[model samples]
Structure formats: C-alpha cells, structure tokens
Target: MLALLAAQLTLALLFGPASAQTTGAVKLATFKGPVTPVLAEYIERAIANAEVTGAAALVIELDTPGGSVDITKTLTQRMTSATVPVIVYVAPRGAHAGSAGTFITLAGHIAAMAPGSSIGAASPVGSEGGELPETLKTKETNILVADIKNLAARRGEKAVTWAAKAVSEAAAATADEALALGVIDVVADDVPDLLRQLDGRQVIVAGKEITLQLSDLPIETVPLSGIENFLNTLTNPALAAILLTIGLNAILFELSNPGGYVAGVIGVICLLLAFYALGTLNANWVGLGFVGLAFVLFVLDIKAPTHGVLTIGGIVSFVLGTFILFNTSELDVPWATIIALALATGGFFAFAIGKALAIQRRQPTTGLEGMIGQTAEVRRALEPVGTVLAEGELWAAESESGPIAVGERVVITGHDGFRLRVRKLTREA
Candidate 1:
C-alpha cells in the first residue's frame, strides 16, 4: 500500500496540473423559458446523466420569467444535494432569472452570472395568478424570505439580506451588482469565459469539498429528449389555450358531421395534451368552465339554426372565457391568440349552422317520407287496394274514398308497409 501510494504521488507531481485541466468534462443544460414541472424533471435527469458520466460539474444556463413554486422547491432541493457540483449560470445579454429562477440561482453550489444578466423577483403569487391579498401575501412572503435567506446564508451577510429583500420586495440586480454584493461568484461574457473563471474554484458537493478543473474541458450540452421537448412545449399557456380551443372545434365538427373518425381522433389527442399542460400549470377551473360554456353555445346554435344570433353570443362568451381562463399573471394566454380563436370558432359554427338550415330547406330525396306529397299514376283501378306507380317504382296502393281508374293522377298521402295511400285528383269537365 505504501509503495502504491508513493507511485501515485510521484505520477501526480509529474502530470497533475496539465492532466487535471485537460481531463475534466462538463455537462451543460440550457433552460430558456419558464420553470415548469417538465423543466424540473429535465434538470433532475441532466444531473443524473452528469453524475453517471463522471463529469466534473453540471452547468445550467438559465433564463426564465418564473413558474410553479412547488416545482421550484423540488429543483432547489436537487441542486443542493447533487452528487457533483452544480453551477447555475444566468446567461446572455438581456436575460433574467426572475421569480423561481432567483430561488434556483441562489441554491446553486456555485452561482454565476453573465454580463448584463439580472436575477430577483422571488414573490409567491396567489391561485388567481396575481399578488396575494395582504394577509396571505404576508404569510407567503415570509415563508419565501426565510427560504431564500437559508439558501443565501453561506454566501455572505450581504447576499442573505438581498435574497430576503428579493422575496419581500422583488429586488433585482445586474451581473456586476450581483457579483459586488456576493450574490454570484463571477461574471463572464460567455460559456468559455465562464469555464475559464471557474477553473480551480473550490466547491462542496454532497458535503465533501471538490475543486473544479474546468479549463479547456470538453462540454457536452444535454438537451431534452423528444418526448420531454414535446411535453415541455405544451406547458406554454398561450399554446395550451389555443390547442384546447382548436380541439373543441374539431370535436364539435366531428359530432355535427358524424362518421368522421379523423377529426374525433385529432380532437381527443389535442385535448389530452391540453389537459396535461393545464394540470402542470395548475390552471383555474372556473376559467375552464367558461370556455366549456362557449363551446356548448356554439353547438346549440348549429343544431337549432338561430340565424347567427347564438353564434355571436358564442363569440362573446369565448372571448370573455379566454380572457379569464388564465387569470393569474403567472399564467398568460396572449390576447391576439384568444381573439383569433374566437373569430375562427364563431365563423366555423356559423358555416355549420348555415349548412344545417340549407339541408332543412331542401326537398327530401330519399326515404319513405319522400314518397308523400308526390303525384302518382294509378296502374290498376284501386278498390281500396290496388297498384300504382310512384317515384318510378310500382307500389301496392289503397284508395281513400272510391275506386280509381287506370292512368288517373293521384296524390300519395302516406305509406303503410309496401302499400301507398292515394287520393285521386279530379279534372275540371
């Protein structure tokens, strides 16, 4: 054992600096949008991947507005307990780590920021998506402030104070300001510069100290898998709303037409995706109810033929419903998308209703009912039971009053099984 240890020490002295810098690797993950459940899952997966690959560190490039508080808490826990160092880089010019992003940045094993980037706004919002009422807001703010303070304590007194202020007042600072205040360790221009600055930095991983040998190490950017990417995209509130509306329209069209499997299938799939997104977002149920009501009005208008009156009402309902569907500031559907969907929905139902009315006005072409009110010629004298030609087909006939002569013009009044009920027409003498 002593001999092996001596040999290893000799080799370390010979090639330590050069090999250490060149042999290290980094696993990079970029989060460029809101912090959703999908994002949290992605981070966890990326961290596991990095650990398995034996990478020196996992660097996350983050830029986000905000997202679910529960998801944010899960992410913070993951970051603090990661097997390897977690470096959170708030990147690029004009980018921000807002709300939940602030919590994540502060939780990093080694927090960093790129030039021009800012971080803050850790306030917790109400279920309605806006600022909580005074009492509830105070409670929520206190909870978040305490959480932030704990995360920032090791950084310094100034960082701890600023972190609490960020939760309470939504305070923000640029990269330079953050660095000066010890909110972040370093500010860099880009990833390469960040790695350069990160080389030889001491960080703790799972309670054990580790030094990052990041200089010139190869970086593998981990991206979301196909399914993850699709699910993550669904978390966009605007896209989810549009998808729901489109899905409903397709279902209604299929219901009105019947026998169209394609529309129904597509509608169901889209609705499933929309519902999944809504679940992740914790969307308001009352808003969903209003949207559902709008669709019901649209369907009613099509069935009852209301001369577009109900369609107009449907449009108003849909627009209003969409406006409130994601009432919270945290969950937003663009007004332009809502207006476009409302118009499209109204027009689609209006066309369907118009077609329904047209069908109602047309003469019946096929069915036993079509034979009624038709002029038929008596083939044989009807002694209450005889034969007649109607609709180009010979049919057994029954006379209503008296026997009818052959070639006499009769009006078909009704049908009883295969026999036609007829009334002879009297010619003026």
Candidate 2:
C-alpha cells in the first residue's frame, strides 16, 4: 500500500504543473496602425509571455494597413514558431489586413475576422508607393507568392491559389468571403464570440496539435509599454512631418539667437525622433531636400529685403515637399495639414520680416546718435556758448548761427564730446 501511494504521488507531481499551465488564462493584445519595429517588438513580447505562462492562446486584435516587408517576415516567423497558439483576429467591424498584414494573419495558428473586416491585398510596391520596375517586381512577387502559399497551404489548395493571387494580383476578400475560401477559420463578432467559437477547435502549434479550451478561461489583456507607445506614435507620417518642421525651426532659432539651451536640446530630441520615423517610413530624400530649401528661403527672406516674395516661394516649396514626403500608397499625409502648416510658417516669417523692416526704418534711441536730432530750450544766454536744457538735463551748448537769447529753442545738430552743437529753431509758420 505504501509503494502504491508513492507511485500515485509521483504521477501527480509529474502532471500537475503541466495541467495547471495548460488551463491558465488566455492572453489578449490589441495591435493597431502600421506594422513597424516597435509594434513588432510588442507582439513578440506578448507571444513570449504567453508561452511562458502556458496560456490557452494568445489573441492579437489586429487593425493595420500594413508596413515593412522585412519586419513582416520577422513577425510571421516568430508567430508561426511560437510555443503558444497565436490567433490573429481582424476585429472591431471595419479592420482589414492589407499588404504585410496579410502574411501576419495567415501565419497565425488560428485566423479570425469580425463582420465587415477584410483580408488580402498583399502585393508588393516600391518604397514610394509606385509600381516596382519589371525585373524587381517579378523577383519580389515570386518570392512573396511562395512564402504566402506555404503559410496558406494548410487551409487548402483554394487558399493557396488565393494567397498567391493576393501577392501577384493584389486580390482581397471580405470576412464572409475569406471564410468561404478557407482563408480564415471563423468570422467572430468580438473577442468573447471568438473565444466561444474557437473553444474545442484543434490547432497545430509549433508542430504539436492541441485543443483550445478558451471558453472557460479568464482573459487578461496585455497593453503596450510606455516606450513602445511613444515610438509607435512617432511612426505617424503627419506627426513625423510636424516634428521635423518644428525641430528644424527650433534649431534655426537657437542658431540665430544663441544662449539658451532649451530650444537646442528640444530640437535635437525632436530631430532624432523625426529621423527615426523618416527612416522607418522610407521617406524620399528629394522631398527632404525641398523642405530644407524652403527653410533656407525663409531665412534669406528675413535677412534680405524681399517684400514677402521669398516667403511666398518658401510656402510653396514647403507644401510641395510635405506632400512628396508622404506620397506613398500606404502613408498619405492630409492636404489640409500640409497647407495649414505652410501658411502658418509663411505668416510667421512675414511677421518677423515686418518687425525687421520697422527696426531698420526707425531712428536710433540711445547715445550720441540718438541726441543728434532734438529740440532744446536755452537756459542761459550765449554769445557763442550757453547752458541748454536738453532731454530734461542741462548741457553746455555752442550756437552755430549766432548769439541765441535765454529761453530760445535750438535744434541739436551734432555733439562734440559732452558739448551740444545747436542752431536756433526756425518757426514753421
């Protein structure tokens, strides 16, 4: 009886932890926007955590227009090889897994979509959103076709054919259509509905087949870290452009009026972040050059008297550059934002020029130069020199015309080392 008890205890010790781990809560993470490196890291972290906890499944609520191909490959490889089952759900009614997003959705152990959601449109385009050259297009399309076909092969031949077409022809499908084509496993209304439908469904994870018991499992949400969120925000084309503009202006201001380090420091930080976003988005160098030229023109307008001509040119260059900067099929900046920023920049420079012109035309207000043109009252009579009350102070003065009587007004013509040269004021009448 003691030996039997020992065997039972040994069996319990061997299987208890495994059972508990397999029955743990489900993990959910929401991913929205472009599939950049920051978001890639977030998804990787979530997958790792789910594997460590032995959760029932890791559900990624996906909403993206897609992004970098290299990053997409990295994400797909990670998801496919993850120890935990990964479910890619295109959710919240209107989301679509386009471009690189298509590969990521297909790489999931279980793919799902909500009503009105779509999938596909995985064709490759140039960094600037134009069609690739013939040679390059053929090469890229073939490789992508092969990769996507492999990912969709398990679904069926129809899915494989459709996946190839998605890469080659840029085909897309709605949730119902994808489900009918076997491209997706289910069309769920939401997370809860997804779990309910996926429960008892068997999926192959990391080469091991297991049934997902998600219906009864508690769901725990995993949110992006603060740094991740900030980096992700920097990926926005409009925001990045705005940052670049502000950074350049701040740096210019610091250079023009040096001393305080606040503008310089902020400029550096913003520039670095903007550059990061630009690199991630693959911005056109020509567009950047145009933007730089616009600022140069603005500075020139301030230094040289152009009467707002250069400012107008700068506004045009700025608007054109901004449009070109984000002229990609997937990344488009709003025209209103670009126009407004350009107008505001032009107005600011115009105001600065107005102030500069005013200063140039105004008379000096200090020192001997400032005292050259003033009216003074004679306090003492002078044959050639006398004391005069000038600028509310008594000063020794020499008369230029002739003898000037006391209380007579004189116009200051010049100064001679603490002495004022004056002439009698002629009555205008």
Candidate 3:
C-alpha cells in the first residue's frame, strides 16, 4: 500500500495541474500615444490577469512617442518578470516606438514590428522639458545606457551595440532593418500574421524554455476601464489645456448664473481631471498661477464691466500661461490650440456676460416680481382682498384703490407674501 501510494504521488507531481501547463487564448493589449504611469499600471494588471488565466502569451500592440522614464522602467520590469511570454509588436504601419518605447520594445521576450513600423531613439530627458544641466545630463544618459545595455545583452552582442547607438545617437530602423540587425525577432502584417509566424517558436520565459502553441487560439483583448480611459485621455497636453480652460470658464459661468448646478458639476469634474493630468505631467505651478490670474481678470472685467481692457489682458495672460503650462518637449500644448482656446474663451465669456447683462436689463418673467405689470381678472370682488386670475393662476389680490368688481380686469402692481396688489384698469381720454 505504501509503494502504490508513492507511485501515485510521483505521477501526480510529474503531471501537476493541466491548466497550469496548457496555454489558453492569447491575451492582447493595445497601447498607443505617450506611455504613462496609468498605462504601466494597466499593463501590470494585464500581466497578472494573464498569468492567472494561463494565457499563452501577452501581445502588446505598441505605438508611442515615449513617456515617463520611471514608469517605463517599471513596465519593462513587469514584462521581464511575467510568467508568460510578453511580445511587444509595433504595429499598423507608419508607427515608430521612440524614446522610452525603445527600452520597452527591446525588453520584450519577443520583439516584433509590422512591415511599415520602425523603432529607436531611446534618449532620456528630464521630466521637466529642455536640456538638463551638464552634470545631470551625463549622469542620466550613462544610467540609461547601462539600463538599455543590460536589456540588450539578453538579445545578443549586435543588439547591445545597436541599442547603445540608439541611446547615444538616437538611431532608428525600419521593420526589415530591425529584423536584419537582430534588434527585433519578426516582422508581420498584423496580429493574426504575427501569431502565425510565432507558432511553434521556442523562447525563454521566466528562465524556462517553452515552445509557443498559439495556432488558431482565440485573442482576448484587454481594454482599459472607463476611468482609466478617461485618465489616459487627460494626459494629452492639448486635451488637458482645453479641459482646464473650459472648466474654469464653466465654473465662472456658473457663478455668473448663480444657483445653476449642471455647469458647476461638469466644471468641477473637468477641472479635477485637468488637475490630475497636470499633476501626472508635472506641470509648472507658476504657469497655473498665470492661468488663474487670467481667469481672475476675466471675472473682474465681467463684474466691473471694463471696456474689454481686463479681457484683453486676460487673453494675453492665458496665452502666456498655456505656453508654459507643461515642462516637457515630448508633450507640447499647440499654439493653434492655445490661440483657438483663448479666442473661444474670450468669445464665450463675452457672450455669457453680454447675455447676463441683457437678461438683467430685461423685465422679470416669473415669480412675485414678475407679477407686476401683468393683467389679472378678479375671480371674486376685491373689496380689500379677493381671488384674481394672473398668469393663468388664481391668487389673493388686494385692491390698491377701491373695490374691484368680479370679472373686472386689473393690472398687478406688486405682491406681499402670497397676495398680489392690483389696480383696476380704466379707459383714459
């Protein structure tokens, strides 16, 4: 009985769980634009989920101009440590993985590119835009070179040399060139083609050699959650700027039209999103101050009724602030967008304030104040107080002069509490 039990235990240990050994559907994640910390988090979650589900491989459809260096490092580490193969594919033609993207692409277990895609330019720069101080520049460049060299050494010597060149010279290559140079593994047309080419290919993952079994497997695309998608969109400099301007203006409009909840709610949400994006991008606070000052000027002009003086100053301040809002060359707020926003902002405030003034000058349309100058018919004789029909509703009306007969038309003069003060209308020569 002991011998039989020992044999059964050995068989079970050799086989283990079938699910853990067998690959499921291919897990896919499509990432585009500037890589961000949010994106890194998304990728991390994806890898965890893929591992849990026994995914055959995690295919990342990547297209980026680069992103945060720290986040890139985190992302690459996650990819390298993943239990399953991580394939980074620069896809859809005309796409190039530049800057931080180069590091991430090279770090993949199997790097690929669509026929028309390209990769390179792994240069690192300060999170704050522009050239760093000399000492800092050298230090950062050296650190990045060492990092890329380490990643490249896994691929081979030629790859290491090319990667070093990418860092030092911002070298780039087409898909064909990348494959030829051994910078990448494959060049295929699309995801399906990529899978076909990858089928039966042996690769080392998590320090163990494994052959891919990706043939005819279902592709499961992992998508960003609603909040993640929203936050990701906020990373765009143009979108962030537009959101900030619109949000401020909306809140200002809400103030101008007091007691309005819709504008205020939307404004607050947009502003919060803008602030979150700005924080992620490491925006200069001084620029924000200038933007705040611009809005203040606008509000002052609207309130004090300047002859466009403050508004003009506000426009200038807004343009200046927008130009300096973000501190990165990779992410620039377009001048066209800024100018358009400035003009639109000026026009929106002008129209909003103008309409507000016009409404203020106009007579009241509802409420106790609105009842004045409106005609009412006496429902019951108004000796002192009686019911009268005004605005299609009957109200208690007190005669201003003498008794008002029933069915006589009277003009509403004013109101106190629920009662309307009325005067009888008479023909005059």
Error of 3 at 272 (Å): 1.0
Write the number of the candidate with greater lDDT, choosing between 1 and 2: 2
For model 2, what is the error of residue 320's alpha carbon versus the real structure, in angstroms, after optimal superposition? 1.6
On residues 1-429, what C-alpha lDDT tens digit does candidate 1 reach at each position? 999999999999987743543365888999888888788899999999987777788899999887888889989998898888899999878889999899999989989998888999777886546567899899889989998999999899999999998989889999999998999998989988988998988887887777788886889999999988989899888988988998898897788769968999999999999998887776777788888988888888877735677778888888887778776555678889888898888888888887889989988877778888888898988987899988788899999968998999998888888788889876741
**lDDT tens digits, residues 219-292, model 2?**
99989999999899999989988899889888887887799988999999999999999988878777888899
Please rank every candidate by TM-score, starting with the best: 2, 1, 3
Clashing pairs in 3: 129-327
lDDT of 3: 0.86
Question: How many pairs of residues collide in each model?
Answer: 2, 0, 1
- Where does the lowest 10-residue lDDT sum fall in candidate 3? 14-23
Q: How well does each candidate superpose onto the true structure, as a TM-score?
A: 0.83, 0.89, 0.75
Candidate 1 vs candidate 2, TM-score winner? 2
Error (Å) of candidate 1 at residue 4 is 6.6
Tens-digit lDDT track of model 3 for 185-245: 9998999999999999998888888888887899999999888887888899999999899
Ten-residue region with minimum lDDT total, candidate 2: 326-335
Instruction: Name the regions of candidate 1 deviating beyond 4 angstroms.
Output: 1-22, 328-331, 366-369, 372-375, 380-388, 392-405, 408-429
| Better-scoring candidate (lDDT), 1 or 3 | 3
TM-score of 2: 0.89
